[model samples]
Target: MEGNHSAHGAFILLGFSDRPHLERILFVVLLTLVGNTTIILVSRLDPHLHTPMYFFLTHLSFLDLSFTTSSIPQLLYNLAGHDKTISYAGCAVQLCLSLGLGGVECLLLAVMAYDRFVAVCKPLHYMVIMHPQLCLGLVSLAWGCGVANSLIMSPMTLWLPRCGHRKVDHFLCEMPALIRLACVNTAVVEGIAFILAVGIVLSPLAFILVSYGYIVRAVLSIQSSSGRHKVFNTCGSHLTVVSLFYGNIIYMYMQPGASASQDQGKLLTLFYNIVTPLLNPLIYTLRNKEVKGALRRLIWGNLHLRKTI
Candidate 1:
């Protein structure tokens, strides 16, 4: 629209900032925020991180990194560069990573819920069952599912016809947005995507609910009120996270097709997509006394070593 009216084939992702001053400020702030999170999470990798809970937490941190990376960097580039247009290939990558990681997080959250359930309900058998090999496989499968989904959905969504306007309202490509943009009859895409998501998300969520149901049952079986209180306190943080994640996603997706308000759509997208990933590590780690203790000891050890030397 500016200098090259008919030169570029790609569409610009104007992103969060149109004002120059606001864009620079937000860029600095967001970069600092994400950078701090990455620094803290990666620095925590030690023998202390060998526990099943920490193992999963590390993977969650990694997913969060990838999730933000998929969307944020491109937005930054668009904000700084004169040409805001993204190539078809770059757009495809955005769609893949966004959905892939979104799906991965859903599965991983269920796994974490199950982990908590076992720790609370079946403490006696926790170590024997949630062993290293099984944990590794689940994390590996999480990554694998995301990668495979990228391969399938990216092409499936992008390869569709582009008869009308090619502009995407979102800062990054999302399924609903891309599907709306597609020229093909989306019946098959809708059905296949629905079934695929239901199997991955709902099935695991059902398993998590069952796990927590048993967990609650176990808690109720406690004779002492104090014992019940302790168990409830231990699981409360995780329950809140699961509730928020699913609640936002369900509200966004399960709406009546007739009521597709764009403002509400963007708000809901921000809630689960941007906010939840940021909160995961902070919530889970703060809730766990072990991780806190490990962090404190790690700091103290470094301080003591410096003094000794």
Candidate 2:
């Protein structure tokens, strides 16, 4: 009974509960759902998007979709009603799935950087190197590492002695928020979390930085300003995404022992979880001519189909 009580505990997620604007939260959720859905739909339907970059992008959009879906619906439920309780199993699933997606995104972005590196630096060998087999392997590696990390960490987090503190102050069953509920000293967990962050977050970040460094050198070696401009434009959207994602994550987890102000942490979480995913489709589609072309064709095709009907 004691084990059951401790292990299978419900959590009260007090996410934005203090705010007066339930409607605003709903609006954000709607926007996120729409954005993620649009990216996935367009990527899948448009043959013009059948390249390696778009392949990774579609996966990223899907990742964002699953990541946001895992938590936001429940958040909407809580924000709309009086009840904010999440079952122990549900919370554990949320933690595992969300973390896995996040970790995947981190590694996926790095993989994307390597793709860009190859495309820019080794234009002649780009196709040969970034073949279907290699692309698949890289994506699988990213996903495998992410799920493996989450499986290791989530259960450990759920098993921590909470001493009956069931209220999670954040909107989700995040590792940091869950750890905060622990009655005992989490020095070891924090240390391990930092190490995991280094592996999952910082190591990939370093690789991205190094890859981009080479990319920049390659881009600059081109004598024509127009040539350099084209290369930079291709890389810009990805760099923005990397900055948005890694910056917030590194800040949050790099120092696991340091407790961020709850309000600040919540705001950062909101930016990455809801806002960043929402912006991804907009960023890639708006900046890339191919995506815009695909969107146009998809829209016209749908219209033509309707007219025929």
Candidate 3:
């Protein structure tokens, strides 16, 4: 075990160093952190935002925040200066957190899709169907599944014998990049990883699609055009978020092995980790009138309280 740990004590994250300008752009991760934090705070503070949708959204924001934080700071540090080396332990933690949080987001998004489906298709029974207990259970299950996935995959990936190769082609300690470092053939491990990826990534995506199918039908059945428009408006933000998240995830994880281009993989990972989290808050806040109104109320109330003081 000591030999294994010492074999590759540290990894050099060769992230976009060739394109120095791109590193400057990645500082936007700070905005991603603030945006997700605001979503969580606003959702908790505002009574009007206390609904099933926002309940799930708060968790989602937390997952995005965690997912981005797991690796971005090190990545930014690597980009900013000469020291790009990360300890083996740091890489392991990053891998576990990123994998677990990512899995949680995938499942949480599907849960959100189900929440939307209930609200749209069973409007009268929405509360009864998606009660607080069920919401909690769903979230707990997502979290549990994600943690299990990380426990299973992180150890397996890190355990692979690197045989002295310590340079990770990508920014973070992602599974694919680490797998490439192994001295032995990784076909069996990759197979297991692929199966797990399908369960974590593809299954939730399929469930989201099915939920949205029912939602679309229910929206179309509305007799009034205005009614239909309202329903679509409520769902559009979630749909956009799902597209952005899942598309990049699928491209990154689904194709495991040498066939995937390292350059393309790095770029996709950057977009997925950095841009997706940043856009999530903008998508939810800008397109969601309920959230916008809640923000306005929260801000005004804060200002009014200060004036009274």
Candidate 4:
């Protein structure tokens, strides 16, 4: 009974099911999104999408799938009245995958920005430069880079001693949450995480910014107003997506820990970790007419098939 009590005190997350009714609603909402994104990505790969833009878009969909899969299924199980807290092993797995996907996503966006620059400025060489093999290499590199980063941080993080209370206030097992639970002094671990976090974000961000600057100059060189408008529109969409991701990330990581001043850290984390990925497919589809048209055609064709059947 005493052992049982201790386990409950360290209870694997019950997740956010305290509200009961919200569980069903969130479940439907998130599941629908997951399904929609899967369909969209599958459609994007239908040979018609050999271009760099759609290639990156599909990668984004894949990232969103990974991001949600890393956390949501467990969260749903918790909502459905399963174990609330994750086992130590499960938390470690989740942390690695989640952080890896997140870090890779940061880099992938930078790659997309560079792809855009090539598409706009060096249209003649765009195909030759971003050939099938190189594009594959870039995408593969993004995944490799992300996992490498997590490999560095996750073990560094999980090795800390959890000698005290281990209840993570948030639904997901964040690095900060796990670090805070450690009974040992976490200053060193936190410092390492901080350095790694910046490493993950800053280099990719610098690349992205430089790529966009060149892209803007290239866009400006287009003497035709119509050509300028089209280029600007495409860049605008990419810019918006970049801003949404980085805004939340910079907000979350920019804190140098003195901000223990409030409970707002959890709220800020939600913006990037939970909320941003949920809305990513929507942002991409809405901004890119090609994606929107493809989705509409897909929906229409599916409906036509259902009627025929």
Query: Against the unseen true structure, what C-alpha lDDT does each candidate score?
Result: 0.68, 0.85, 0.89, 0.71
lDDT of 2 by residue, 1-309 (tens): 554586677889988778757338545766777877887788888877777887898889888888778888788787678998999988999999977988999999999999999999999998899999999999999999999989888888889888778998888888888888887888988888888989999999999999999998898799999888778777999999999998888877775443766767777777788888888888887887778888899989999999999
For model 3, the stretches where C-alpha displacement exceeds 4 angstroms are 1-8
The local distance difference test score of model 2 is 0.85
RMSD of each: 4.3, 1.8, 1.5, 3.8
lDDT of 4 by residue, 133-242 (tens): 88889989989989997898788767666545667766777666666656667777667767777777877888999998898888878899988887877788788878
**Model 3 / residue 239 / CA error / Å:** 0.8
Better of 2 and 4 by lDDT: 2
- The residue pairs in collision within model 3 are none
Writing each residue's lDDT as its tens digit, candidate 3 over 187-222 gives 888888889889999999999999999988888789
TM-scores for every predicted model: 0.84, 0.94, 0.96, 0.84
lDDT score for residue 89 of model 2: 88
Q: Which model is ahead, 1 or 4, in terms of lDDT?
A: 4
Candidate number of the best TM-score: 3
Note the clash tally of each candidate: 0, 0, 0, 5
Candidate 2 vs candidate 3, TM-score winner: 3
Error of 2 at 97 (Å): 1.3
Off by over 4 Å in 2: 1-4
